[model samples]
Target: MRWPRQVMSLLVVLALLVGPPVALLTVVGPPITGWPTSGQLRAWVQQPLTEQTLTAALTIGAWLIWLMLAYTVALRVLVRLRSTSALLRRLPLPTPLQATASGMAGAAVFGITTNTAAAAPEHSPQPLAAGTTTLHDDAGPGGGESHTIADADGISVADGWIPRDVAMQVSAAASLVWLRRRRNYRPGLTPGDQPGSDLAPLPRTVASVQAALADNPAPPVAPSSYAITRLHDVLPASGIALTGEGALSVGRGLLVTTLLTTQSRPTASLIISNAALISLLGPAARRLIQRLPLTIVESLDEATHHGHPAERRQHTNGPRQAEDTPGVSGHPAVVILDEKDCDGGDLTHLADLSMGTAIIVLGRWPAGPTWHAASSGHLYDPHDLTVPKLRLCVLDHVAAADLLAVITPGEPALGATAAPVEASEPVRPNPRLPRQSTRYRSHLSAADTPRQRLHLRVLGDPQLLIDGEPLTVRRSAGLQILVYLAAVHPTGADAAQLTDAIWPGLPHHALTGRLYTALSDLRTSIRDACGLHVIDHADDRYRLNPAQLAVDLWHLNAALRHATTAITPSAEVWQAVVDAYPADFAEGRAWPWLDPIRETIRRRIIDVCAASAAAEPDPDRALSLLQAGIRIDPYNAALQERANRLLHVLNDDNTDTGIGSPYRR
Candidate 1:
């Protein structure tokens, strides 16, 4: 390829130099009287050349050679000086000095390629040969970043470097800079651009947390000031309160994340003694910690010692810190302390330090009056553990037992962990009575045992009655969870179903983890108090083990089923069903998940009452029963219709005034 190109270059040069002169002499020279014979022309060609003609041919050849030499020199200079301009840009210099250096570089490049002024007058321009030819050379930088030339009609080549690559690189750098500036600028809400200017957009995790809190029936109160706020609206001013040992274990992580996300100030800190609490909250809670700039201290000592020095200050009278006042910045530091078997003085000292903190003390409320005073909204009391004020949670006793079984290894757990005590009573025998139906009677006397079998009453406020002693399930979620599981018992429920029923709006990832934690808390509380594993699991589904479980709701449901199908249900059976359902299903829960079951059970109760009244021998007894049924469900058209018919019959012995209507109105 190279040889061919060189041959072409030589031919082009020779044609330019020789073709013109031959053309002029042969075609345009003075015309002869007649055309010369071939012998004559050959003789003329053979004759010696004249000095003028020889000079003209030599001069033309010399110009062609000079042009070729100039082209070769220009190409070589461009190749050798490829990196010189780039190197000059990198040197450190003042702006003015750098500009001067750049100008000098340009002058030097032009000086190398152009003929000197002194040599300009030595040669004059020659008329180029006829016809157009274009040439280009790509011999420069290794990359596509190279110089190119476009020569047309044999015109002289353009001078100086036209750096295509360097210009593109500069434009790209400018575009990146503009994009970076645009990305960093954000709009603010306040004209002054203060700390809360934009009021930080609420994180999506808040929705999951909100859903988790809603699992309980108790209403959470957000302060008037926070009514319009994002995350704060879902949070209570008093923070979340957990009473039972099980509830504390389950609700701690959820509470921590809630407090962190909805903190009054962006820079609030989270201080707790339990690292396991964070682990229990699951990946979603952990992710919340990452998104918020809150710091978590595992120990109070760390909070005191490792906290920002500026946060702690000394006053002559006492140590005055911002934490002394609750809601100082409209939010308190979330502090969870484990006080089981802890020293009283240490508890008091920590309490004093945590005055402004949303303190959740996980342990039995101290024995005496002074310690009892410690059991405020912030304190977690085993005896008085009630439904958490802010959030809803649901757990069944059996499922709770399984959960407790899982977290037992982490005993005394982070949030609601209690020290396990030795069972003082001896084991007792539970006698089996003759069964009247498929399901056995709920009552069976315990012959002295270390622990009593649990009796859960979910008809009203769910209560775990052991040995005639009713245990308080302070957490609303705790009771709700038990009720939901019982409502869907025997067949059991998968995690997704339970999550939807309990914490309905939680993100899927967070829902499962929260559900497990809640379940574990239930199991732990039951086990710690009653020493029973009431809940069982198989194939990722949770159900109450009938062998080890006894729920009043179950017994009530059984009685209701038997009464509806029995050929002649005795007054005793109907009475038993009525007694079992002392209140509506999951009374006070009123959750959307509980509504359907609640209505069904209500209708069934009405059915039993209405049918019982129809079969009564005495009109007064019949009227009383019908009236009670109507009282239970005023909207049940059947009960209302039955009561109306019974009243008409009682009023007139002979006349048939009864009318049937299906609608409630």
Candidate 2:
């Protein structure tokens, strides 16, 4: 099947190039009998519009047009070939594999380009269909009021040309798959043993890393293991010197520092000289560094002294063989030094201190491999001409701060406390209770209600419902945007805030188009389903249109708030609160920003269930409530202990009545 398609494509291209010229020569050329000679052409021009001369003129013009068209096609083909060649050259793979991968990449690009061009006309602005209303406003970014559907289509086309990022992501995903297979095949290799084998492509942005982690959700590798940090592609794990000047070098250094410290648990014992820390990492990164597990010393001498006792002893006594000195605490000690504070002598002395330690110098080091960092985050090795230049990950102060904020743990959430429950006490039931209201009623209602209602369910799998019918969101990112907006409801979020929360670590400018496209798609989907606008944008912030949309999370929180503050907390109200929580907030989704919220909500519901169980007067009913609480969180020790105690009480009562206990130990 593949061969047939390939053959047919080749034939079509060949025919296009040759068919018109051949046809002209075979059919039209006989009458003209070849081109006119120089004298004949002058005579024909002087003759003034004879039929024969006009015929000759038309034939020449047609031939010239064909030549120009063919040249243009050839030029485009050449460009595509050159780009493909560059891509192949950059890949760090065997020649055969490189060829195969490059061919696949080329085919994919061609197919995508063809499909996009074909689909362009289909996406062009069409007349409003029956019963459909215009959804988008004419307001433009320049504050103009004359935007048109054609302008939107033009934006889509212009943005379509730069799907290079998508291709890069696809290539990186393939590399990840290969790395996984390699690891599976060679299961015996420890994380530290095969450093070179860890040559998988690294994500270019922090947002990408977060998405990958959320999708996989694996535990961090242990400190004793040699964890590899990504720098665009892969950084050599054996270690190399980084030499550059100004902000670019500093940004790369900060990126490396953050990844090494936080990407895995206890990957290495990191030591940075105080001089390097102050000069290189600015205020934001320094604040983050303070919270990380690393040591900062005044000088390289202090760094060597801070090593393990065995290493210190070895350094004081004499220079042992390289293999004799293990690293600090069985983990490799990574020492970061600045050329300003460190000289050739310091490098020599540190090398003798420990063999397992990796030394990363911030400037030139003649004795070791050195990479020059450029302002654009590309690495160049003058000494190693065989390796191609590669881009490395670089993070500025703002980006680094955002990354730290996301990874760093904060204070314990409210209601997360493990309060003890008294099993012996039986709370008396309230004498009076208030009437129960409808569970899913919207508090925020407008005078002119729309024909349909929009409901967002985040308790379990995120789902959007319109008039009780499920709506399918084609893009995962679009659904995520909606969910995030609902989570931070009425307050809303600006472009920067939204980008940071949804696509963390990426520059807002870089993803501006993507954000706009997703928003447009979301608005279109909502409008198509029920001719009503569900999102409102104002003051550079986007929020759900409160009058039309309702979230289950809002109702759940309201119930909890009432339960906590009530004087004689109604049992029915507490039960309603318990029943409202079908699952954890955004259950089964692991967006990093949603974690704290999810935990807080889960803990609050657990507390409410336990409190409700304590207030029940009947033993059987109280036991049932505790069982329900346990089902929500099996690891809650207080809930577990209370349930066990209640079961014992029930068993004792049954035994006294000479009845067999249904619940046996």
Candidate 3:
């Protein structure tokens, strides 16, 4: 066994066995390039025997063997390299046996490689690329404020909105289909919530306010970001609170925002969150948002649907009725909202889609850096901007409860706030007043003051004011009929007059029932009238005890008489006149058959002004009174001429005996 002899022996042995299979692989593997790929090969092995893969492979193998045989001697040398031992063993056997063995072996190797691939784990799946975010994908039911949201493309709409955010993908796809065929819908919210709407409906939202907690809101966003509005119930939670106007400033790093169901009036509030409260100070900011003809983007799909077509059309660009405003946010405030600037949903969606899911308009965004507007309709481009990450807050119910006190103000809640007492004179309690237990309470605010004060907050129409505020009343006809009684208090109107005033449209018995309800509701809504009863109610009439309540008209009459009787009136007399007339006495407020009473008060005010002009000690003071009367009744030629004549006479040192003079007239 010399080295040369060993090499020689090994080559001859290797050539005989390895040569053939190496040759077979070279011949077979290349042609299969145009055939099944590695992935396809793997799938073939998993199928039943009759599948195309098994049949195709067998046919290809036989064809290769025939071609090899056609060049038998030329191929035999190539096969010698693949498997020397097997090739050697088959070469000596019958030719049919050798060919069959070679083909079978090649087919087996191909199948083995493919089957191994089939068993391996799946190949890496590519990550999703960008530019595909959409509103249809992002918004859906239960798609409100959430712990985490995917929003690379503003409003990642693909995630179908639901209580849980798992179906986003299917939702995204479905939204595309739905959006093409339908209009987006934003629910409407009235500016002032009515007395009882949400009470009976089962809540649809998962209770929120967790979003306002520490470490609860989504991580703070970057500067100059947008924040969307969100929906919340009257749950017991109030997030961060900033009070006063200066508390909202850009320098202090706060955003100016507001919420409102009513359009012109926004509740005072500021959003402390991940959003830019963009203020339009110059042409730049204006250019971005103000492309008006005062454009409004109302969803008109309702127009293309059923129901009263006329009733559904919105006349006002924003909310026409205060009660019908989409007063969407938690603690609603006054805000200048641009509907076109925002997305499809109302205020709530505006919160969720922007910086952090919170916004406020009226209350005040804690005063931030201030800027002066050089011109009207100024706008600012946000790119040249920076601000601290707004700390978002979700106000819990406690804060809402406190704010509620301010929004709805009262000593005894300007309307129906008290329960009634027993006997009209005895003033027995009605037992329905929120917390009062005393059987009888004073009608005058405190211990028997000479005058009574009434504060009203009118919710229906912005009509007249006895004081410079809204007038209050119960929704009852009989109780309101008492207004006429008091308007003529001290010299009270007769009972037959009272019956005709209240029961003009009622059956006789209806008067009793209506009166009872009116009296009961009024006692609950008005100031206390201790030991105050309808005395002399037996024969179609009733009168309030004159001492029970201080009547405005009574006070006015007293002031008038005092002024008229005093000659050479002092400043004190003028002060009495000023104090008597607080504001325009109850302007547009009235109930059934109460027009005459209203007219009487209206006339009295005019008369009192006329008398005061004549009674003032200083000619200038008299001129001022005459001028005020003229302003109140611009069309009154007599008042206008009288005022002019008075001023002219005063300027002339009262020497003129002009016929048109206020004194002569």
Candidate achieving the largest lDDT? 2
Over 1-665, each residue of candidate 2 has an lDDT whose tens digit, in order, gives: 59999899889878878998899888778435666689977887788599876786788888888889799889989998998897665333333544676688779879889857644565536543221212223221222111111111111011011011222222233333333323232212343563232322222233344353443232322221122232312434334567764334443334344334433434345667776666555754466665555678787677767655465445444764443443533345566776665564446556555545666667765656788776434466767777765543345544444334333332111112221221112111221212223322333356544578889898899999998898977655677788877765444567776676665544476667667777777777887787667666766677666566788877777777777778998778888888988887787774645543554456567667777778889888888777777777665556767788988998999989999877754
Off by over 4 Å in 1: 1-451, 653-665
Clashing pairs in 2: 223-266
Q: What lDDT tens digits, residue by residue, belong to model 3 across residues 221-291?
A: 32222221332221002112223322223112111112211112332223221122233122232232232
**What ordering of candidates by TM-score runs from best to worst?**
2, 1, 3
Supply the TM-score for candidate 1: 0.34
RMSD of each: 36.3, 20.2, 35.3
Give the Å shift of residue 522 in candidate 3: 3.0
**What does candidate 1's lDDT look like per residue over 375-455, in tens digits?**
111222234446232222222222222222222211121122211111111112232322333222223345533456677
Local error of candidate 2 at residue 387 (angstroms) = 5.2
lDDT of each: 0.45, 0.56, 0.35
- Candidate 3: global Cα-lDDT? 0.35
Q: Point out the higher-scoring one by TM-score: 2 or 3.
A: 2
TM-score for candidate 3, please give it: 0.27
